[model samples]
Target: MNAYLILDLSINNFESFREYIEKIPLFIKKHGGRYIVQGVEPEVMEGDWCPERVVILEFPSKENAKEFLGDTEAQPLFSIRHKSTTSKLILAEGCS
Candidate 1:
């Protein structure tokens, strides 16, 4: 089954964050993951979860998702994110 990494991020430093954001797509591609959604304008029809930003990434499988997240080449970009935003992330398996 496919897996997804869903992120709800609140950015604090826009300029610094931009640099890191730019690097993510290539990293995902390198790991054979695809972007299902990235920072689309949110619609607040009704909910307490007014997430500032949302990203959903689809990977071939849960193992692929874990490997992508644990990649050493991608580790440094985290500091840029850490310095720029607070984020909530979850990994879940897709229904087969």
Candidate 2:
């Protein structure tokens, strides 16, 4: 089964986030992950759920997604993200 990382973020510091963005792609690619959606304005059909930014990443499997999240190479960049934005991130497995 495939896996996805879904992110809803509100950026506090664009400059710091830019640095994180610049460094994340290589790690994503290395871990068999690709962006499905990035920083797009979302349509809210129902309740009061609106986000400043949304990111969706697809990985080969749940394990791969976990590996990407835990990657040592991405640690510093991950820290940057924490400082740059307030985010809610979730990992979900796709139906096989």
Candidate 3:
């Protein structure tokens, strides 16, 4: 089964976040993950949920998603993301 990592982000510091944007793809590819949806502002079809920017990534499995999220070498990049944006993230497994 595949897994997805979905992010809702409000970027406060674009300059810093840009660094994360530039660098994260390498890690994602390394972990067998690919972007399903990159940076996009979603159109709300339901009650009161408007995200500034949304990202969705797909991985081969839950383990791949977990490894991407927990990479030690990516800690600095994660910090950059954390400091530059108010973000929410979730991992969901696709139905088999």
Top candidate on lDDT is 3
lDDT of 2 by residue, 1-96 (tens): 999999999999998899988889999999999999988878888999998789999999999999999999899999999999999999999999
Worst 10 residues of 3 by lDDT: 41-50
RMSD of each: 1.2, 0.7, 0.6
Candidate 3 collision pairs:
none
Per-residue lDDT, model 2, residue 7, is 95
State, as a TM-score between 0 and 1, how close model 3 is to the true structure: 0.98
User: Local error of candidate 2 at 2, Å?
Assistant: 0.5
Q: Rate the local accuracy (lDDT) of all candidates.
A: 0.88, 0.94, 0.96
Candidate 3 residue 29 Cα shift, in angstroms, is 0.3
Off by over 4 Å in 3: none
